[model samples]
Target: MDFHKLKKELITYSKEIGIDKIGFTTANPFDELKSRLIRQQELGYQSGFEDPDIEKRVTPSLLLEEPHSIISIALAYPSKMNERVESKKGMRRGIFSRASWGLDYHHILRDRLKKLEEFILTRVPDVRLKSMVDTGELSDRAVAERAGIGWSGKNCAIITPEFGSYVYLGEMITSIPLEPDSPIEDQCGSCTKCLEACPTGALVQGGQINAQRCISFLTQTKGLIPDEFREKIGNRVYGCDSCQTACPHNKGKNFHFHGEMEPDPEVAKPLLKPILTLSNREFKNKFGDVSGSWRGKKPIQRNAIIALAHFKDETAVPELIDVLVKEASPVSRGTAAWALGKIGGEPAFAALVKAKVVETDSEVRGEIEKALNYYK
Candidate 1:
């Protein structure tokens, strides 16, 4: 079988199927990535979301039997929202990062992968294949970097020269011996913008990130955000894009290549106060389609409370008081207590004093006490 001719045909078909970019790499074990994973694990820099087994993460062969090569695909997303929602005076909105602006990318990428898998199977009748998006064991960034889809940028994003870092990445492992594409050279020369722009100093150095300190990761946590990072989180309700936004390479690189990636002005940048009161069903109806909702409503609600505090939105004080008094999630209740203190007024202070009397949870009580001290 002419594998080279087949690779050309697959590339052509990929373009026809709306895949923005595609590349191939030999499925050798990722040695460098294993070392980085070990170091990240040792230093406790990893977000708890990563696959725990380092061996499984770095070994593609372990994931798919006799994998000969891996195909990486990228779909560019718009960096700038084409339409804007005006936040009137006394009203503030929280921003989900560019990645979460549209429909959940996992579903979109998976659909593209399934199509590619079918296309390959039609050509090579007995082809073995496995595909994965972000949740998979293999590192999507590592695969994209090796497959020449893009270079691993200083912000830990795969930065394609054409699409910049604002691209969704996914991969498929296949048994075919397709010729590997050349990896891009490091293009972040002498640029410390991403490092300097990181609010939590999560970008420890070029191409390395301490995810534990990342605001993007922090916004996804389902517990009370650490006090030190809460103020730094700003109005980000989902992921943080400070590093990506700061990259010079990404300048003027917005692309709206796919219709599904377009952001709904109200959904992508929803009002902060409204988010505080969303019922479970309301939250699902509004944000379930976005990738940011993967951790569910608790994290988004918690972050919305923090964003209100960041804005010191006096109008939201009443709603925050209600959350402190009635919210079931201790994280939400505790964060509301903190937000009330941050936006202190006679009413907000009174509510805190009242919540302090009945709040039984030790952590929530501690937060309430800390908030009360803010008035003093």
Candidate 2:
């Protein structure tokens, strides 16, 4: 079925469905990715999702029975005014990264791809289609690069000239043999802004990211954040975009993908007080639809406590004292003690001392003692 014409029709249909960019290519073998993941595993970069058989599981070729073509697409979700993104003095900006500012990309991108597939089926009835939105075994950046969508930048993100690194990537794996776009050449010369701007040194040489050290992954990972990395996480209560913010390629960019894709102002640097009081139901109602809510309120609450602690805002003392008094979660108690220690003063000391007496968890007790030491 004329592959070139099919690809063109697919791109046209995809745009109508609201996707910003679309390109077709062969499935990447991800040989380089597998080797890099192995090395990262050795270095303890993937501690949270460290599966011995990760290479076997996440490989692109292993996902589909007889995958012949890949259709990669991009969606732009840019931040609104620059004021929302600007760094504040005592309080950090609470903006979601550019990609996550709207409805979850997984659902949005999948819906668009489904429509594209339906259009293809009308043209070729027997076409077999499979798609993924970051859940694929495929190396998304690799597939994106191979499709001429964008080059993988030093921050380990796809960088398109039009959308910069702010575009979300999704793909379709099909049995049909569509003509493929050639891979784009790397545009990052000697610039190391992304690597240099990484607070925890997660980005090493040659676009490698240490997931264990990545603030974005750590905040979402279902485990106690390692103490060494916690301080470096700073005020990023959710995902981080420090490297992307530092990239010259991402600065002063215009997004023309979807007219409705504006960043939500309420989420852009929200007050520290309200976020601290989110009930589980309320948290779910607000964030459950987004991709960041996969871990539910536990991690986000933990991160909020951490960010408040890192900010050392004395204003949070009253709310923290309330949490210390009534909150039952051991993790909450432990983080509260840590925050108290960071906030350090008469009020925080008194709360820590009171919490220490009633706290049963050994870890929480330990944090309480550490906090009380500041008073001494």
Candidate 3:
């Protein structure tokens, strides 16, 4: 009946339950986003991780019957780790991006959505609702932008004034006719920081990204990283945040509002050499809870090898040699071959020469050859 009063109640309950921000918007089809998605698809810019169906992604009505309005919620995560892990002379560490610093945000955001759903059910007993996080067909950023959660920043992140771009976003589509909130004004006028700071130039101009070239997206792929981007990836074992970290809007905006989001320094910034040797069980036990580990340990290990190369970590040369000779995944072995070359010594060079004789995989052999050249 009184939808306005109900919206007020939902906002109050959301804050009480740790939702950092909440907003409402009509369930009209996202025409603009659909066009952009088409363009991204045409240009081969998509990361291959998004929903393939353009209609399903932009049309909320298809997701839920007669969806009248959408509710968007944001949970702020800490940008800075309160505790620090020391990287000594002989030991180097790789950093997981801020989003993956703590617990997997999917679990945290889902918990908040579940609470909101229960609260809504109490007031509107027959309310029809659908909720989703990053993996959902509906675009979380589009919903958040329409719902006034934040402006779409140049980095392609929803930038909330209070929390900057360091916030996890999710949404619920409902049959309730809640009043829609106005979208925020674009604040990234003439700011090329994100575009300039992108290592692979993934940020195309402004307000758009070529996900294929994005270091964040590349780190998540379960294959050999392109040779051009490998050196640019540096020590990022998970996602890359150069774009967000470069945004002026995110300055001094760290918020440790939720306990689940606190980083375990050792897990978030672990020693590079240890990651090279993690068993599947060991990787799961240590990084299983973080969002970045969703692709399993192969990509992380691959990135760890690259990070060792980035640092030219001589200490990791032995472990990298083992991976080059014995790792099951070709991506891992190939990456290790590259790392060994980057950290060249008599032993590393000898191992590459040895592996060159027996390595059958064309890709692995190619990487070994490349490493040998680099070593010379």
Which regions of candidate 2 fall more than 4 Å away from where they truly are?
A: 47-61, 81-93
In angstroms, give how far residue 143 of model 3 lies from its true place.
0.6
Residue-wise lDDT of candidate 2 within 1-376, one digit each (tens)?
6888877888777777898889888754767777877777788767454445766434556777777888899887664543444445545435345555656778888888888888888998987788887766566677788889999999999999887888888888888888888878899999998998988888877578878788888888765677787778777767888988888998876665564455455564455556768988888787766666777877777777777877777777888888777877777778878888888888888888878888888988987887787766
Local accuracy of candidate 3 as per-residue lDDT tens digits, 28-108 = 999999999999999999999998999999999899999999999999999998998887656999999999988999999
Best-fitting candidate, scored by lDDT: 3
What C-alpha lDDT values do all the predictions have? 0.93, 0.76, 0.94
Candidate 2: clashing pairs of residues: 94-269
Give per-model TM-scores.
Answer: 0.99, 0.92, 0.99
For model 3, give the RMSD to the true fold. 0.8
Q: Provide the lDDT at 334 for model 3.
A: 93
* Total residue pair clashes for candidate 3: 0
Candidate 1 lands at a TM-score of 0.99
